[model samples]
Target: MTLTLEERVRLFGSPIPEGFTVRVVESGTVINDEIVSDTKVVANGYDLYMTDKVFETMRDKCLSKTSKVWGEAKS
Candidate 1:
């Protein structure tokens, strides 16, 4: 079954705020794209957007960034 963005965020602590609506999309990059989880975060119809590079960097650093703040919401 497919889950919505909010569900995913709720089930797994979000690195981004859930106060606003967000949409995730695949970022098609030419270089080694197959090995990378390229994603873009779009909020409120592109009013705010995170590039794939920025997204990936943030994702890679998320655990460290929010670990203390969110306090590990996993089992």
Candidate 2:
């Protein structure tokens, strides 16, 4: 089964705060070359009405960028 953004965030030891919402900007891949476990998510509100500055501020405080590039980076 596919995991939600909250579950994936918990995998990294950072859970988003209450009243904050996020959506997947780019779905993660499970391929050989790029094994991105966590998707690219943005701090958009529940109805996608959050402003950029507020979203960015919350994202910076709550989330982190996840990447798992193989070969040179994944060694």
Candidate 3:
């Protein structure tokens, strides 16, 4: 089952930043060429197989857009 952003935050008590998704996987599920037993975070070009706390912290830094960029995004 796929966990929505809101559901993830509420149910798992983890922050799922924008543009990312959480997926619940079955046992022996192949993810990123590795066998996964539980959940995975689907990123832009890859999947992150991690626990709730690690995923929460990583997503917060990587996808939250909280860091400053050197230049403005060009349209």
Candidate 4:
């Protein structure tokens, strides 16, 4: 199903209750050394996964300054 940007944002950005955090994982990555994987956010007793396309787009657009800083810090 094709969702509008507003809908997508609403669906993905809704806040979880206190004492919970979102877990984001990329597709095709292993968790605990297992091949089969699912990417989702678990928070406040809820589990959610953004669509693959959305996840990829967001990941690609995210700033890497933190990673660059970490690399520089390590050097």
| lDDT (Cα atoms) of all candidates against the true structure | 0.49, 0.41, 0.49, 0.41
lDDT (0-100) at residue 46 of candidate 1?
Answer: 30
Estimate the lDDT of model 1: 0.49
Better of 1 and 2 by lDDT: 1
Which segments of candidate 1 are over 4 A away from where they belong? 1-12, 22-47, 64-75
TM-score of each: 0.33, 0.25, 0.32, 0.25
Ranking by lDDT: 3, 1, 4, 2
lDDT of 2 at 53: 49
For this target, which candidate reaches the highest TM-score against the unseen true structure? 1
Model 3 clashing residue pairs (backbone): none
Candidate 3 lDDT by residue in tens digits, 10-70: 5554555455566544556566576654344433353445555554555664433322222
RMSD of 1: 10.8
**How high is the lDDT of residue 25 in model 1?**
43
